[model samples]
Target: MSTSSIKFYDRFSKLYPIVDVFLRPQKRRLFEEINLLDHGKLLEIGVGNGTHLGLYKKHALIGIDTSKSMLSKAIDYATQEMQLLHMSGEQLEFEDHCFDYIVLSHVIAVVEHPEKMLEECCRVLKKDGSLILLNHFTPNNFLGYIDRAFQLFSPIFHFKSAFYLKDLKALKKIELKEQIHFSRLRYFKLLIYKKP
Candidate 1:
């Protein structure tokens, strides 16, 4: 990530809860996209303010983030069973094939080296594990052109990334389990991939 991006998150972390209130509906859709009880050793990347903590409270989870203020809120929101870490998703500090499930909420796109981060995600995931990614994906048509055009203004928005499934380079080992659209306009998508 760039220095400016880090600074932006640091400053926004203070008001993340309020910001998250507006995202509750999307967050709820993300939670509904997966069946949590079926998995174990869950690792949530970009666990901002731990807004999704309640969903994973009963499961063994480790949530990671780069923002200190966001992590502080995670610590306060987390249960004794949950663990929170101050780290970047691009460089995960975990053993290979250690986690049964890897969860990402609007994270894969914004990171500096999304391909590298996906590689790391694949490395830590067990052979039978599943990867759940929830984010906005370009539609591969006219709307996609608009999303691609937005990349020119990425530094300004600092929220959206022009990430498409076709752009993922280190994903030959996983099979696409499903792709579900979360928005009426078909901008947001939920992708489920499982290692065979």
Candidate 2:
């Protein structure tokens, strides 16, 4: 991540709680997908402000993000049972098959290398564990053209790498047991990928 990007999120951390209200419907679905996991250690990447941490029930939970400012806001909500790591998703610090569930909400789009991140997610997941993702991507229509146009002129404003859309199409090849798209067509997508 660039210094500027880090700064953007640092500033964003302060306003995340208020900003999250607009994302409630999507967040609710994300929580619902997370609830499918029975029990065990859970790892949430890009866990900004740990806003949804309270919704998860787990014996051990670890939240990781590159932004210290974001993690700081989450400190109060995180108990001794939950751990927070200031780290990036591309280079996860965990060992193979370490976590029972991994949540990648709104992360794929912003990552510099989405494939490497997914590879790491797979590496750290226990056998049969799940990877939950929520993201916004180009629609498969005229809206997609608008999305591309926006990407051309407002690349920095969008900040998402082009591969985000490609990854959505490549989910099957990655060995996901299930991939479901939820939400209205153009704006958001929710996916559940269970490792085999």
Candidate 3:
């Protein structure tokens, strides 16, 4: 992530509540999927305010973020089962193939280099491990054009409005295991990938 991107998130951390209002409905399914997951070391990139930390009971979750303000907000959700770290997803600090699962929730498009982030995720993930991605990947329809239009203002918001799953270079190393649409508008998708 860039310095400006980090600054934007730190400054706008308080606005997440308003963002949450529209996001909560979709997040219900996201959390449901996560809550049912059985895993070992799991990394949740961009853990935001950590409101969903309690939802994860069967996994040892380690959440990482580039913003200190966001990490501070997520502190309250920390537990023996979960650890919060101030780190960049594009450059993870852990050793190779350490995590059993990596969850990239609503984060791929917001980073400065989405591909680099995925590369890091894949690097740290064990072979045969799952990478769960919950993101807004643009479709080929009118809704996609709408997202593309918003790309102009994405810099001001620090996120891409028209990110596509095909643009992810990390796909070369991972196989798409499942793709599910959870949002009411089918704008956001939950993609499960397995590293070969």
Candidate 4:
């Protein structure tokens, strides 16, 4: 994340909790589409305000975000066991293949370099571990062009408008386990991929 991006999020942090209310339904659907069992170490990249902390209580949880304001809110909301780190997804400070599971919730679209971030993610995830994604990707149609056009406003929206699942370079190393689309327009999707 860029310094300006972190500043933008810090400014937006106060309202993020309220904004997340509309995201609850999709969040619920994401969990329903995947199985989060006794995986030992679970890392949530861009864990905004620790709103999903309750979901991974069974695992040793680590949450990372770039915004200090957001991380502060997360600290207030998260249980003591959950470790909150002020970090960027593109440069993860972890040993190779250390995590049992990695979760990206509405994060890939906003990252500066999605491929580099995914490369870091793949490097840190243990072989046969899971990578779960909950994001809004461009559809493969005319609407996608419209979505791409909307990239002009990404600075205001805080995420790129044209990010697609097909753009991920890490896909070649993982097998798609399940995909569930929740939006009426089929824009929002929950995807689970297993590292090979």
**Winning candidate number (lDDT):** 3
lDDT of 1 by residue, 41-116 (tens): 9899989888668866345899998877778877878888888998888899999999988888877777878788
Better of 2 and 4 by lDDT: 4
Candidate 3, backbone clash total: 0
Clashes of each: 0, 0, 0, 0
- For residues 54-130, write the lDDT of model 2, one tens digit per residue: 87765478999988999998888888889999999889988999988888888777766677788888889888877
Q: Model 4, poorest ten-residue lDDT window?
A: 30-39
> For all the candidates, what are their Cα RMSDs to the real structure?
1.9, 2.3, 1.4, 1.6
Which candidate achieves the best TM-score against the true structure? Answer: 3
Question: What local distance difference test score does each model get?
Answer: 0.80, 0.76, 0.87, 0.85
lDDT of 4 by residue, 1-196 (tens): 7888888889988888887998999887765543455647888899998776776647788899999999998887788788999889999999999998898998998888889988999999999888898888899877798898898988686789988778687777789998888856788888888899
Residue 170's lDDT within candidate 3 is: 81
Distance from true location, Cα of 50 in model 4, Å: 1.5
**TM-scores, in order shown?**
0.90, 0.87, 0.95, 0.93
Candidate 3 — which residues are off by over 4 angstroms?
183-185
Cα lDDT for residue 122, candidate 2: 85
lDDT of 3 by residue, 1-196 (tens): 7899999999888998788788887677877777776758899999998777777778888899999999998888788667899999999999999998998888998999998999998899999988988889898788898998999998899999988888888876899988888645678898889899
Root-mean-square deviation of Cα positions for candidate 3 versus the true structure, in angstroms:
1.4
